[model samples]
Target: MAQNNSAFSDSSVHVDVKDYYGKRLQKTADLKTGACIAPAQPLPAFIRDALKKVHPEVTARYYGCGLVVPECLEGCRILDLGSGSGRDCYMLSSLVGEKGHVTGIDMTEAQLELARKYMDYHMKEFGYKEPNVRFVQGYIEALVEAGLEKNSFDIIISNCVVNLSPDKKKVLEEAYSVLKDGGEVYFSDIYCNGRLTEEIKSHKVLWGECLGGALWWKDLLQLAEQVGFSQPRLVTASIPTIDDKELQDLLGDFKFVSATYRLFKVPRGNTKSCKVMYNGGITGAEDVFQFDCHYTFKANEAVEVDGEAASILTHSRFAEDFTFQPPGGSCEPCNKPKVSVLLHTSDCYDCVVLS
Candidate 1:
């Protein structure tokens, strides 16, 4: 195939991404896992059930980097960026229920066609009366160009697809634009352990698919800030295992980390806070959960009488959401050195500010 030689052409960009992914999608069973870290939780049983009900041909062509929407989404209007073959979108459609909708955007006609063809089958399998998901052919960077409105969706989702875009900043901007004021853009994608070089960005096979042009973590933070969203929150993590024999020579044993992002457009000047007490329940739980999403608190961050006291946790950057007077009239004797004094820092962002 010849190149499109337009001013937009980077000379390095090659091939319709659809053909590249279509082949890769078809051959995923034996495909080498090149530093692609999968999600911690397995795909939801509802989704796996739906996939099984769909004909084998459809499942054979389902290829994606990770499941991005593990949040408790009972009724969210979700927009999936670069939703190839509508796999994730259908899962969201089921989770969001009949009142909700899923919109999938992709640039490849072949992939979009395949996704659209399954609309009836999926709707019936999920026992929905109408098609709750739609597919649009376009780029993630220019989502508004395809008729999306500002501040409309409850949840904006993406799966290992943003790295394929030539204009990721614009993609971040557009994502922030379409989200309702409190809406969040939840996504999972590949990130290099270190910063990426321009040469890696231009790798034809890598960029043509979704592996080569991943963003540096710091750059992603800056873009989220630029887009008027709070800093992204990480909910899960895994490391990618590379398999490219040739690229291995160039990028030797480089680690790839996969993480989920929850970026929100916080309300103006309104800082929120949550009093977190570790119940030793969540992952790698300690005797108490002391770490804030952004920074780790020193031991005794939360005042506990016996490793299990319920006191309002306070941070300098956060307003005490719970207003409780001490057990006495002021600072109570119940505090009897049972808890240590903790100092809070002022360098907190608004995203987690609403903790």
Candidate 2:
């Protein structure tokens, strides 16, 4: 049994998690299950080089399930919830550039200490003018106490940590609160196809290993919608296996997947009535782009999308990267023909008719 000796919280779940990350686990090898590890996915060379530069000590303590990196991060402000050992923070430091900043928050002091230990070293190694990444010892479920300002960060990321939070809904709500209007919450965590029983939830070993704490996929979707993030997009998913037979038996028939999802804090509109066209504007995505699991936009191709989807591309950080058209496929004249022509006067052909 893991004893919670941390000063973070009184809840048994929080105590166990703090103990698990702060004491019981020292390295990835100490984990009893493969749940904390992400499935094999080929990494791009730039990302591979960034991972290679991370301190060995940081990698040794990492226990995440997936690569939750999103694009357009050059000058974006990023926050990592439960950023153990600052592994992702350091990686993001190389990507966010000198003008950008990365902040990591964790409840465990031991992890925070290790993360802060190499701050200067990493800053010098990355060739930055000054330190751009900082670590804060705090709870993911409560960000205000950590002195985080609302509507501040451009992007918030968590890797296999949200499942460990005793208050997942609060964690998400806080995430939404701290993010800028066009910002996004891109994260990777464990999810089960079915709900777990009280018995499983109470198991200390299972919870620490991240299996017993998994949220049902559908419930996670519902929770996201409940908190104003009405549209949650799944980026990647893979089934995870438990090598320990004894623990696997306790898991019973529950199927768990390490899934990465991105929820944007944009206006919730019925994207059902919009048409979109990508102008090959975004640097790397000049030809075609996969907006989510359901939508794809080809360069110069006007694709029909719902109002919500249109709002996602136009109102969010991706707005300048693409052009938007209104519903009914009509850039034609209304009561005022000259007004219609004025609205259509652009190389991108943005004809979104104001209702």
Candidate 3:
């Protein structure tokens, strides 16, 4: 069972979120803090072009913290948790092509109504013979109850919304339950330096703004392990500036950053280190494929990888994109630890997993 916060029940948090996102927030400009704003980074040309095709209204209402698009999305089924305004869903709909499908789930009826209203427009704009995206009204913590089948999605992506949930562990558990073996959950959201006080968690406005219920970055590591997913690989990170004086005062020494992470659901085994080379087939990444912050594989160049990374590349959807040499077959022995401890410093822009 999912545990709720002592200060607020699950139902109360849901109500507060619905009221804030549905009734109070009229547009992206209505956001009081930078926590929900998209990360400031240059996107690839392909992604920029896809964003251009989305309806202006959908883009205008987007409140996500970072870009959730992952590589090799050509024919995969995707699920967007808290798909507000369906911005990421619509963008993904184009990337997934006509043969693939995308599902957007949200708790607020108003957001779902808005997301559903533009289905026809996006399909026509993408030149698809049929619509490839759909929206569901449900909580992220209870995906099975919302009718999403087990092992149904190839990838699940959420943006800036998980922090708003009262039970973060339940959300991860549900995500793991719904993904196929070797599938992944690639998401971006707010993370604080440490666990917050009850007073901070009890603040309605702070909670609604995606500040109050933020997770301590370390807790995410334990949660992923508990839910049977691979250790999270940090993809990108950037500090979010809190401009509100009152909120800043309330959060005296605590700091926040919008970070993206990728966790895989691969078969459990003691994978050995191997040398792998990219074949250069993924659409946008024809020359180099960056698996995470630590490893980047250039086309046709054999790069040695650790055991965990070796497992992810071998078992996930990216398997066909690379050629792997058998472990110990002319490959250097890997001396790194199996578990990489993530270390976050107060002044650093991003956290790194130290092997």
Candidate 4:
């Protein structure tokens, strides 16, 4: 669902992307590549059951590359950019509980229409007196103009949609502007190991399928920093399934991966050496809680973490779920947090300190 014209100077690519997602690719199976598939790891029982509650019609049109669901979503305000057919929005609605709200925005009217059609049904199914989810027609690049307010959302999620925007930086900026200080944008999309050629960038089928429009992994990190989000956490990552021989030949060893990255909007702090304790209280993850691919905190155990990790646990929405203890004999907060583990192939884990 990620389509944009900025990768190339041509405007036709943009038109093709709208046309393909709006009318051409009508279902999940309509996608020819592995861009929209689910994760290799099996989802937990609660999440799987919640997904089953999503109307089949909505899931039929889902084109996301990775799982967008993050931990501790209860009672949080969420925004889903490029929320095609409301698949993830509805699932989030259930996770955030009745008090929480979800807003979905997309430029494609046809997809939005399908998402809107099931609102009443979902509200009734969730046993809510009032509906907590709604779909709006708009582009992801201009969220403020689309009626989204500044510093309003606790979490924002997008599914394979950022690649389709020509102004990827603007999209990130708007996302940052709308997020609360502790809010985070956790999205799943396709990223290539290297930059693509102009010919590849302009390929209509490739662009619409999320291949040709993929951002180089390095470029994505740079964009995050430029927009004031440094040291993005790699939540999950996987190699894309490029089964099409013709497409494979066109790619020519340009490795692509489906990665989910989370960027927090809090002040960039030095990595403080600290320890955290998980109380075994979260709904699904009681015995152990996986913060990202790198760290998992077990119940009643004191887990040592770098400054960035400590900030994530002590300052963000997940703060209440953890108890933080800073490094011994040091009142100075960690300014430059560094992670020594390689959570993914070719990933840079330099934790940046904000000014």
Candidate 5:
């Protein structure tokens, strides 16, 4: 595995994160900035019900920026990167069910201990014959070294934890290596308008708060391309407020948003545009399947999709959920309005309007 040789050592960053989440912060209430907490939104009924079953102790320690749940999760093997307190892992356990499995990996021992402490409790609560979830102690940037097989997981999720890594590129690389060809890294993390200075990056409090280590939003595009993943699809975003006056002044003009994006590991090539209709079998999104900020497929309605979207629909786990037809013959692309590009320069903190 490649290590980041910068003014700050990778080991030092790991130590700081462990100290912050393990010793300094006792619960979500102990967090200094709102960047780690996701903004409120109406969730699907099934998701809301699943969350209510998670252990209160585990939910209390959750500090994620946004919900990382993706559709078509019935029997898919999933991995959770930086699965602090196992909050997501336990919730996902119910979604994946008895046949599917969820593995959570976190570096902090204290968090891991708490996660394992409830293993039997959650299994009984979910009424499972046996436990389908397991917790591993490992770093996100070094998953292969941590004993995870390459091309193994159907999906991987991270919530507000990617920014804490000193080498964000390494983290993406590791995630790409572990995912199956049709798999995806669906995650939510803190993103800033522009890159921060080294002075801000060095601040332990700022980094721990998930502000200083945030990636410049544009940089994520380049990183995904470099890592050989499909273009990131923006799902949702919200502005995170820094309430502390001292921290706000220290941040100056820099702005941060909690954003969720999904990057797929599909074949690298251009696929022709096609007409697709959702069959609508996925749980929670029965009537309409919202693919991203730009695309929403109503059940049985044939909509023309771009090459990238077509490829994702046909090649991934969702292939079974939709039917596809070639564009421009019987399908006729002109019948429906083409997807529009929404400009979001003014609402930088709310969402990224993809072109």
Candidate 6:
């Protein structure tokens, strides 16, 4: 229900929103991404591995607001949303190995062209005989229409692009449908802690730029469930601090968090029951923290953190999103993990339930 007043200026019908900034060209960032692009420059360990096989141009032109690569990508079909210049795709190409396939999808023509041009060079650089990469010109929401088969991909990855879609709900549904029974969706995109009202989301420039169009974290979790995904776990988040007092005044409490989330689409998670494991004080915690908690479980449940039992429900089956909390114990805080409800058949295996 937001109309694009900034980009289109038509101000007539309320459009879902394609982009707030405008149509993407060859560049990775625009007005919408703003300072978010700065995060990519640091390049996490996972990101470094992904960039190793890509060309300098690819890295230079890359515009991602989140980290998408984790260690679980072996022999998996990886899909990169808004895969500009095929940077992330090529990174996955090597990680998935020769047996796997990496598909990069973006609506930008110039970016894809550059990506295609470097195909041969990347294949050689990564030591692959026949590059296991492909690029398709399509919007993130139109992936199924782009000739992609259903229930196919093993891992679906997107870096700060999903927020640009006009139809966020539709995108989530399509994503869930495409993953294999035990597959996953590991992505990093901008998510606002509070609501993104119709006014802000309607701004064509913001939507196109991939800001003010972010899904509310709470709404995202609900959508994941509505579309059949478990609770999403936070992999890594860069908390915005007031290191610079001036920047804090302009931004307020609003912070940018680039988290790698995992959602398993299989029924295996339901079988997991509650069990307590005590690893003592947080594995590497410099301070002690108390968590108010509760929970129990059935049988065959495979989720239990070696550290604190209270946070077992927070462990993500997807290798990347798993983060440790309080030390394992039999206290009330150790009852059950949050959103640890594993669904039965007709769904995913390692999917996390984001509360």
Give the best candidate by lDDT. Answer: 5
Cα lDDT computed for each candidate against the true fold: 0.60, 0.80, 0.86, 0.80, 0.87, 0.58
Off by over 4 Å in 1: 1-16, 22-25, 30-32, 35-37, 44-55, 272-355
What stretches of model 6 exceed 4 Å from their correct place?
1-35, 38-50, 239-256, 274-355
Q: Comparing 3 and 6 by TM-score, which wins?
A: 3
Q: What TM-score against the true fold does each predicted structure earn?
A: 0.72, 0.87, 0.91, 0.89, 0.93, 0.67
Report clash pairs, candidate 1. Answer: 35-240, 35-241, 35-242, 278-289
Give per-residue CA lDDT, model 4, range 229-321, as digits (tens).
Answer: 856777767766878888889888687778888888766776576877777878778887766666766777776676776776666888887
**Minimal lDDT window, size 10, model 6:** 284-293
Model 2 bad stretches (over 4 Å): 1-8, 270-272, 281-286, 328-355
TM-score winner between candidates 2 and 5:
5
Name the Cα RMSD for model 2.
9.4
Q: Which of the two, 1 or 5, has more TM-score?
A: 5
Q: Give lDDT tens digits, candidate 6, residues 223-339.
A: 877887765645544432124344334334454444456565754244433443333232121132211112223222223432222222333233233233333334334434333
Number of the top TM-score candidate: 5
On residues 1-355, what C-alpha lDDT tens digit does candidate 3 reach at each position?
Answer: 7764432224888999999999999899998898899583568999999999999999988998887999999999999999989999999999999989999999999999999999999999999998899999888998988889999999999999999999999999999999999999999988887899999999988998898989988899889889999888877777787899999999988888788889999965679878887889788889877666667667777777778888999899999998888766653333332222343222233342111
Residue 117 shift from truth in candidate 1, angstroms? 1.0
Name the regions of candidate 5 deviating beyond 4 angstroms: 1-10, 332-355
- Model 4 lDDT at residue 113: 94
Which 10-residue window in model 3 sums to the lowest lDDT? Answer: 346-355
Full ranking by TM-score: 5, 3, 4, 2, 1, 6
The residue pairs in collision within model 2 are 270-307, 270-308, 271-306, 271-307, 271-308, 272-306, 272-307
